[model samples]
Target: MAEDLHEIVARALMLDRSAITDDLKYNSIPEWDSVAHMALIAELEAAYDVMLDTDDIVAMSSVGTIREILKKYDVEA
Candidate 1:
Protein backbone atom coordinates (compact mmCIF):
# COMPACT_ATOMS: atom_id res chain seq x y z
CA MET A 1 0.00 0.00 0.00
CA ALA A 2 2.91 2.29 0.73
CA GLU A 3 4.30 1.54 -2.70
CA ASP A 4 0.91 2.20 -4.25
CA LEU A 5 0.70 5.55 -2.52
CA HIS A 6 4.15 6.48 -3.75
CA GLU A 7 3.33 5.44 -7.30
CA ILE A 8 0.08 7.36 -7.32
CA VAL A 9 1.76 10.49 -6.07
CA ALA A 10 4.57 10.11 -8.56
CA ARG A 11 2.18 9.59 -11.44
CA ALA A 12 0.02 12.55 -10.48
CA LEU A 13 3.00 14.82 -10.06
CA MET A 14 4.82 13.55 -13.12
CA LEU A 15 7.65 12.49 -10.89
CA ASP A 16 9.73 9.36 -10.61
CA ARG A 17 8.81 7.05 -7.74
CA SER A 18 12.31 7.53 -6.42
CA ALA A 19 11.54 11.19 -5.96
CA ILE A 20 8.76 10.57 -3.49
CA THR A 21 9.57 10.48 0.21
CA ASP A 22 7.82 10.56 3.55
CA ASP A 23 8.91 14.13 4.00
CA LEU A 24 7.51 15.29 0.69
CA LYS A 25 4.93 18.05 1.09
CA TYR A 26 2.51 19.78 -1.25
CA ASN A 27 3.91 22.84 -2.97
CA SER A 28 7.32 21.99 -1.55
CA ILE A 29 8.58 21.44 -5.06
CA PRO A 30 7.76 22.52 -8.57
CA GLU A 31 5.81 19.37 -9.40
CA TRP A 32 3.59 19.52 -6.32
CA ASP A 33 2.00 22.91 -6.81
CA SER A 34 -1.71 23.64 -6.33
CA VAL A 35 -2.69 22.16 -9.69
CA ALA A 36 -0.78 18.99 -9.02
CA HIS A 37 -2.30 18.85 -5.55
CA MET A 38 -5.81 18.63 -7.01
CA ALA A 39 -4.69 16.05 -9.51
CA LEU A 40 -3.14 14.11 -6.68
CA ILE A 41 -6.35 14.21 -4.68
CA ALA A 42 -8.23 12.83 -7.66
CA GLU A 43 -5.68 10.10 -8.11
CA LEU A 44 -5.88 9.09 -4.47
CA GLU A 45 -9.66 9.00 -4.51
CA ALA A 46 -9.67 6.84 -7.60
CA ALA A 47 -6.97 4.54 -6.34
CA TYR A 48 -8.46 4.09 -2.88
CA ASP A 49 -12.05 4.24 -4.04
CA VAL A 50 -12.68 6.73 -1.28
CA MET A 51 -14.17 10.18 -1.56
CA LEU A 52 -12.30 12.72 0.52
CA ASP A 53 -14.13 15.50 2.26
CA THR A 54 -13.04 19.08 1.85
CA ASP A 55 -11.37 19.07 5.24
CA ASP A 56 -9.39 15.98 4.37
CA ILE A 57 -8.42 17.53 1.06
CA VAL A 58 -7.27 20.68 2.80
CA ALA A 59 -5.31 18.66 5.36
CA MET A 60 -3.46 16.65 2.75
CA SER A 61 -0.52 18.97 2.66
CA SER A 62 2.20 16.31 3.06
CA VAL A 63 2.76 12.66 2.43
CA GLY A 64 2.52 11.92 6.13
CA THR A 65 -0.67 13.92 6.40
CA ILE A 66 -2.12 12.10 3.42
CA ARG A 67 -1.54 8.78 5.14
CA GLU A 68 -3.31 10.07 8.21
CA ILE A 69 -6.29 11.37 6.25
CA LEU A 70 -6.65 8.13 4.34
CA LYS A 71 -6.71 6.32 7.65
CA LYS A 72 -9.75 8.32 8.64
CA TYR A 73 -11.56 6.75 5.71
CA ASP A 74 -10.22 3.34 6.80
CA VAL A 75 -7.88 3.32 3.82
CA GLU A 76 -4.75 2.28 5.59
CA ALA A 77 -1.39 2.78 4.02
Candidate 2:
Protein backbone atom coordinates (compact mmCIF):
# COMPACT_ATOMS: atom_id res chain seq x y z
CA MET A 1 0.00 0.00 0.00
CA ALA A 2 2.84 2.34 0.80
CA GLU A 3 4.34 1.58 -2.58
CA ASP A 4 1.08 2.44 -4.27
CA LEU A 5 0.73 5.58 -2.24
CA HIS A 6 4.24 6.55 -3.17
CA GLU A 7 3.54 6.09 -6.84
CA ILE A 8 0.27 7.98 -6.64
CA VAL A 9 1.89 10.94 -4.94
CA ALA A 10 4.74 10.94 -7.40
CA ARG A 11 2.53 10.71 -10.45
CA ALA A 12 -0.43 12.81 -9.42
CA LEU A 13 1.59 15.44 -7.64
CA MET A 14 4.39 15.38 -10.19
CA LEU A 15 6.95 14.80 -7.51
CA ASP A 16 9.90 12.52 -7.96
CA ARG A 17 9.85 9.40 -5.81
CA SER A 18 12.82 10.80 -3.92
CA ALA A 19 10.83 13.94 -3.14
CA ILE A 20 7.97 12.13 -1.47
CA THR A 21 7.63 12.81 2.23
CA ASP A 22 5.24 12.25 5.09
CA ASP A 23 4.44 15.94 5.00
CA LEU A 24 3.16 15.95 1.41
CA LYS A 25 0.10 18.16 1.63
CA TYR A 26 -2.71 19.07 -0.73
CA ASN A 27 -2.23 22.50 -2.22
CA SER A 28 1.02 22.81 -0.27
CA ILE A 29 2.66 23.16 -3.66
CA PRO A 30 1.44 23.96 -7.13
CA GLU A 31 1.21 20.30 -8.05
CA TRP A 32 -1.08 19.50 -5.15
CA ASP A 33 -4.06 21.60 -6.12
CA SER A 34 -7.60 20.36 -6.72
CA VAL A 35 -6.82 18.48 -9.90
CA ALA A 36 -3.97 16.65 -8.30
CA HIS A 37 -6.06 15.93 -5.26
CA MET A 38 -8.71 14.31 -7.42
CA ALA A 39 -6.11 12.31 -9.25
CA LEU A 40 -4.55 11.17 -6.01
CA ILE A 41 -7.89 10.04 -4.63
CA ALA A 42 -8.70 8.09 -7.75
CA GLU A 43 -5.31 6.45 -7.70
CA LEU A 44 -5.64 5.56 -4.06
CA GLU A 45 -9.14 4.08 -4.38
CA ALA A 46 -8.02 1.95 -7.29
CA ALA A 47 -4.96 0.70 -5.47
CA TYR A 48 -6.62 0.14 -2.11
CA ASP A 49 -9.94 -1.20 -3.42
CA VAL A 50 -11.99 0.78 -0.97
CA MET A 51 -14.01 3.93 -1.36
CA LEU A 52 -13.12 6.81 0.89
CA ASP A 53 -15.82 8.13 3.10
CA THR A 54 -16.52 11.86 3.11
CA ASP A 55 -14.78 12.41 6.44
CA ASP A 56 -11.75 10.44 5.32
CA ILE A 57 -11.59 12.44 2.13
CA VAL A 58 -11.70 15.65 4.08
CA ALA A 59 -9.06 14.43 6.50
CA MET A 60 -6.58 13.37 3.83
CA SER A 61 -4.53 16.48 4.32
CA SER A 62 -1.02 15.12 3.97
CA VAL A 63 0.97 11.93 3.48
CA GLY A 64 1.18 11.49 7.23
CA THR A 65 -2.56 11.98 7.47
CA ILE A 66 -3.03 9.52 4.62
CA ARG A 67 -1.19 6.89 6.60
CA GLU A 68 -3.58 7.35 9.45
CA ILE A 69 -6.59 7.06 7.14
CA LEU A 70 -5.29 3.93 5.44
CA LYS A 71 -4.63 2.39 8.84
CA LYS A 72 -8.35 2.53 9.58
CA TYR A 73 -8.90 0.33 6.54
CA ASP A 74 -6.19 -2.08 7.74
CA VAL A 75 -3.78 -0.83 5.14
CA GLU A 76 -0.38 -0.09 6.62
CA ALA A 77 0.75 2.32 3.94
Give the whole-model CA lDDT for all candidates, comma-separated. 0.89, 0.83
- TM per candidate comes to 0.93, 0.88
Worst 10 residues of 2 by lDDT: 1-10
Give the candidate number with the greatest lDDT.
1
lDDT of 2 at 7: 71
Candidate 1's error at 55, in angstroms? 0.9
State the lDDT of candidate 2 residue by residue for 1-77, as single tens digits.
25667777798777898888898787788888887888888888877787889889888999889988988988877
- Model 1 scores a TM of 0.93
The segments of candidate 1 whose C-alpha lies over 4 angstroms from its true place after superposition are 1-3
TM for candidate 2 is 0.88
